[model samples]
Target: MLEIVLMHPDGKLQRLEAPVGVSLMQVATGAGVRSIVAECGGSAMCATCHVYVDPAWAGKLAPPLANELEMLECTSSERRPTSRLSCQIKLRADLDGLTVQLPESQQ
Candidate 1:
C-alpha cells in the first residue's frame, strides 16, 4: 500500500492508504476528499484534480507529459513549480509517504 498525505488550505490533513498503481485522483476521491473535482475521472482531460506536490517527493515521480501540462494550464488556481494534476500521478510502493497540497479552489 502507498500512504498519501493530503493537506487542505485550512490546515486540515488527511492520511490515506491506497493500493499501489492507482492514480492519486482516484484515491483522493475514494476517500471523500472534495478538493479534487476529478471531472474527467483519470483521463487527464481536466485540471480540476490539480495539487501541489511536496518538494521533498517532487523528483520521485515522473515529469508531467504534454497532455497533463496542457490540462494544468486550465486550472483556476495559480500554478506553482510543484503543481501537478493528480490524475496523472500513479501511486507506487516507492511513493508510500507522498504528500500533496490541495489547491484553494477547483471551481
Candidate 2:
C-alpha cells in the first residue's frame, strides 16, 4: 500500500493508504475526504477533485496531461503552480507519503 496525505484548508490532515494503480481521487473519495467531491468520478472530466500538490513533492509526479490541464482551468478555486486533478494522479510505490492540499471549496 502507498500512503498519501491530504491537508485541508483548516490545517486538518487526512492520511490514507491505498494500493497502486488507483487514482488519488479514488483513495480520497473512498476514504470520505470531503474536499474531493469528484463530480465526474475518476474520469478527469471535472475539477471537483482538484488539489494543490505539496511543492516539495510536486516534481515527483509526472506532468499533467493535456486533458487534465484543460479540466484544471475550470477549478472553482484559484489555480496554483502545483494545482492538479487528483483523478489524474495514479498511485505508485514511488509516490508513497505524497502530500496534497485541499482548496477552500470545490463548488
Best by lDDT, which number?
2
Query: For candidate 2, what is the TM-score?
Result: 0.97
> What overall lDDT goes with each candidate model?
0.92, 0.94
Runs in model 2 deviating more than 4 A are: none
The residue ranges of model 1 lying beyond 4 angstroms of the native Cα positions read none
TM-scores of the candidates in the order shown: 0.97, 0.97
lDDT of 2: 0.94
In candidate 1, what are the lDDT values of residues 1-107, reduced to their tens digit? Answer: 87999999997989999999999999999989989999888898889999999999999999999998888889879999999999999998999999999999987
Q: So what's the TM-score on candidate 1? A: 0.97
> How many pairs of residues collide in each model?
0, 0
Worst 10 residues of 2 by lDDT: 39-48
